[model samples]
Target: MTTAGLSWFTVDAVGAAAPPDTGPLLLDLGDFGSDRTELVGAKAANLARASYAGLPVLPGFVVTTHAAARVRRGEQLPEQALRTRWKQLSGNGTRALIVRSSSVAEDSATSSMAGRFDSVLDVRGWDGFLDAVRQVVGSADAVGSDAPIAVLVQPMSTAQLGGVLFGLDPLTGDRRRLFASVVAGLPEEIVSGAATGTSVVLSRGLGRALETVGPQVPGLTAGLRYRLAALARRTRSVFGSPQDMEWLVDADGVLRLLQSRPVTAAAVPPRHSRPLGTAPIAETFPDALSTLERDLWQRPLDEGIRAALELSGAASRAVLSRPLVHSFGGRLAVDLAAIGAAPGPRRSWLDLIDPRTGLRKLRAAWRIGRLRTAYPMLVEDLVDQVDEQ
Candidate 1:
């Protein structure tokens, strides 16, 4: 995510219901990061990183894991600090609060507890905030782990739009593409899949709506889409990997980050076969492309190549152009245009031998190229034997 200008709008919605400040220190959400996982839990820690990075995270206080343990033990509430914070927020016309679970085991490597945890919204006043905290502690066991669970208390946002953003394409596992499941208003229903949300894809830094799954989301300005994609890319960089982020835009058109986690599943191992549009490689048996397919096969270049077909520009129309060769059952099909192109990172020895051709040697070269394309290892063995002779 570039250092693009992403705005933060504080609306007329709810503010946090902080506990009485009379107790020992409770960490500010901005003070924590990924390193403070043991104290603040995963979500808070990530939010801390976002805040530290100058992201417009909503101001909030963490009811730390230790606080949760203390609360669960039935400690007496000082109650004054809560009133003081509420008074200050209410002074700014922010009256509502959002209480969320920040459990140690919730956003872990093994399990994320997606759609399983609870988030209390529109909580108001100190009593409501305390009740919400009690509720988060109450369901500790079902949320998992013996570790004490923390509750993240923040201002409730009334979103004009909201959605879940994936830093990379999910279906194809393409790192070059980012995808979002977005809704016009709040995303709670859409998140649960109770409603069909708009599907958005951000690829090569450009965003487009793939399809409108259901109801009209309405507020999809181009600027908003760009900001969303840029933010997704940036956070993915910060995490040093792909990220799964829950985000929202308020009625004022400002972006708010709710939560983010490393996309553990996104780190898929590279395929044995290479993808088209990229350069070819030497390995053949499992997932390699041959440098000499054109010679042995004698296939029509314009017909067999996908890239060559595109050379004619708008005039290059095709009935049903197919790839010269398939990779990984057609997932990484060869770009036909590039079949006879120059060598790249994974060059073939056939190219070195192709320029100086003789009749007998041509036949031999063709045979070698053909075999190299078909049985690369066998060709290598043959060449080794001839070199020995």
Candidate 2:
């Protein structure tokens, strides 16, 4: 059985690294890639490639599958080798470490052995470290001898919050949506089915909140939402597939990539399946438009909205790069979700009390201030030109 609440895709060589010839007893996480999965295992290989591609990954080393295979055959662990690496990782002998399993069969495109092995967290001292390694290696017995397991050890992150992000909505298989679930402190509770996390769903293109569940978390800021959306998009671009990513936000608000794999099973909708609405737009047109009218007006309206989205910084260029207005049964409907057009600021005075939305509200206010400044100047120019004409 796969682990609960976590699913991810295997790597597809966005940046192929030649297998490091470094002896396989232990190696840096950056030393493996898709080409070295046999030696390092899928999880370690993915991390190495991601770090190489400039993603924010914690520095660490892997006790390679070669060593794990030997241990599985009832051989002793390379304790001296582990101690040397632990010194290098700990630096001060006080830093706690997290040990995770990276099985050769885990995170595979065909069969994601999601959390099928074991992980140890917040380990301290040599004795604890050795026990943690043994625990991780022993957990591999669940999958038997077929899948050799490598052990990954890294300095534990002092995370303020942690969760998982799906590059696409796993439930709906909607590629245009990003789904995330976050909880306070380490994400082990949420990943292990001990806690129900605050869930957030966003339009992938615009990073606009489509839905949010659970109480408003104090640090779940809109900027974080945008960043998560961008992270999902970038992972897909980097790995050539939609990914299930485990991430953490440290005390400093910096997001770090912890793990990533593909969504082995998901239902992807067709391009035309995007939900369309005619609420405010219907009020203006009210009925199906003639071909001549659609031909005459669609492009201009699309351009106007595109320009407005650009000016507001509410959406990215990629979101606004395409024509958003579409004809359905000769009636024009816009993908407001894609365009990120909302019914103006839905804010109450109570919003001032929440720190989470402060940056977003400030940005909105600043944009409004600029518009206020520019409108008068434009009107003055218009009046002057009218008199001259």
Off by over 4 Å in 1: 1-25, 32-35, 89-94, 209-216, 266-389
Kindly list the per-residue Cα lDDT of model 2 for residues 1-389, writing each as its tens digit. Answer: 11112221222246543232234577887764433788778888888888887888889998888677666665566666577789989774689999999888888666677768999989998889888888898898855647777998999988888898888876546677888998988778688998889998888976788888897777788888888888888888889999888999987889999988887752444433454577748888898989999998788877887767666655545567766788877788886766654322233577557564556446766988888999999999999999999
Q: Write the per-residue lDDT of candidate 1 for residues 1-389, one digit (tens) a residue.
A: 11112111222225643333222335667553333777777888888888888777888877677667766666533345444554554444357888888877766645677766667878876777778878877777655658757777778888988888888765545677777888876667576787667887776386655434455567777787788878887887777877888889986889988888876552432432223443453332334335565334324533545443333221123312434554443223444233534211233588456543344345555666775688977778999999999
Quick one: best lDDT, which candidate? 2
lDDT of 2 at 167: 89
lDDT score for residue 188 of model 2 = 81
- For each candidate in turn, give its C-alpha RMSD to the true structure in angstroms: 15.0, 16.4
What do the candidate models score in CA lDDT, each in turn? Answer: 0.64, 0.77
Q: Residue 376 in candidate 1 has what lDDT?
A: 74
Reference-based TM-score of each model: 0.61, 0.62
Report RMSD for candidate 2: 16.4
How high is the lDDT of residue 38 in model 2?
A: 81
Quantify how close model 1 is to the true structure by its C-alpha RMSD in Å. Answer: 15.0
